[model samples]
Target: MANSSSTRGTSLDPRARRTRALLRAAVLDLSTEKDLDSITMSDIAQRAEVNRATVYLHYKDREDLLLDATESTMEGVVEAARACRLSVDTHALPDATPTHLISLFAQVDQHRAVYRQMLGEDGSARCATRLEHLLAQAWFEQLTAEPPGSPHETALQVRAHFLSGAVLAVIGRWTRGDFDGEGEDGGGGGGGNGNGNGMSVAEVADLTWALIRGQK
Candidate 1:
């Protein structure tokens, strides 16, 4: 399947771009209110203020549009992970979570609803797979940038995939409220504002970094 990057440089007429933007926004808005499985093409069209035919003209199906809509949300995560300094010397790692890592969790928290829906049991495999690949690619780049004694290509690939999958799993569970009340402050839960009682972004980021650095 074509990845989200496939559409990056493809030029669309101004009108077409506007229509796509509207449709993407409409779907994202609707997703927060209901399950993705229950949302129909006609519903998306109505929300976008376009006819049903217009929706089909832009996307092959609801999932295709959803993929497009949610694609932008992952960019912050990949960029933040790439910027992180995953030091090999555990002793050298900062006690506090890196700002980039915090940003990564904040990005995910900002879109908690969409992510919870997409990464849930009934969520889209394509979406999860795409995110995993992007994250793995970012980690692979970092590993390759290490000094001459770095791991072999196969080892790097394995480590990258493992790290990315672990990160995604944490994100998935956090969004699903599995970590609620464990590491959270007394703040209440509701808005995806990262201030919720269920594992704040900083707490998750700290835990994730601790695990990454092999700290107890």
Candidate 2:
């Protein structure tokens, strides 16, 4: 699962890297065409223009290939969050929170398709669980070194999981078209009149921050 270090190690020669990249891209493209359950190692290998045996050399099976393909996007999310946390801690960012948070959301927007497949109803629960765990761990680290004071260990765990879950839930909905265009809230309050796709990256970031800060 955590292949980041190994990926940079000697095991990944130039040819190996190219093969893996091709496999990942092929899986993603094929996913857009058909259900993941129907996808097989042969399908992926064929799409990547590689033999089935070659796929077996790099990945154990179809699930392995799918996870590897998705993890890159998830890693990007974590890395962006890490950078944002560092910026906040170092006071290097001008608007600190919002700017970096927006950047993180922008990265999410970039990988929305991947997230949709991983976190959606018919997708892999393993991928969603792993992403949540990573995000929660990152938040736990960030919260432990804060000013207003860190929570008790148990509370910190709860807070971290809650934060991660909340963020991902919102993101899943956003990417799934939950906030597309305008709709009344039954109170007849006018809607955002959005483009009917979803919130802009900035809007999502702003909304995310407000939620984190416990603001309306």
Which is the leading candidate under TM-score?
1
**Shift of residue 91 alpha carbon in model 1, Å:** 4.7
Which candidate should be chosen as best, given lDDT against the real structure?
A: 1
Question: Model 1 off-target regions past 4 Å?
Answer: 1-9, 88-92, 181-195
What TM-score against the true fold does each predicted structure earn? Answer: 0.89, 0.80
Over 1-216, each residue of candidate 2 has an lDDT whose tens digit, in order, gives 366322333467899999999999998787666656677999999999999999888887677778788777777688666555621233333442556677777677666666656766788877788788988888778767666644577887888888789888976766655676422222111112233444677777777776566566
TM-score attained by model 2: 0.80
Q: What is the C-alpha lDDT of each candidate?
A: 0.79, 0.69
Cα lDDT, model 1, residue 215: 81
> Candidate 1: minimum summed lDDT over ten consecutive residues — where?
183-192
How big is the positional error of residue 23 in model 1, measured in Å on the Cα after superposition?
0.9
What's model 2's lDDT at 21? 93
Off by over 4 Å in 2: 4-10, 86-97, 147-149, 181-197
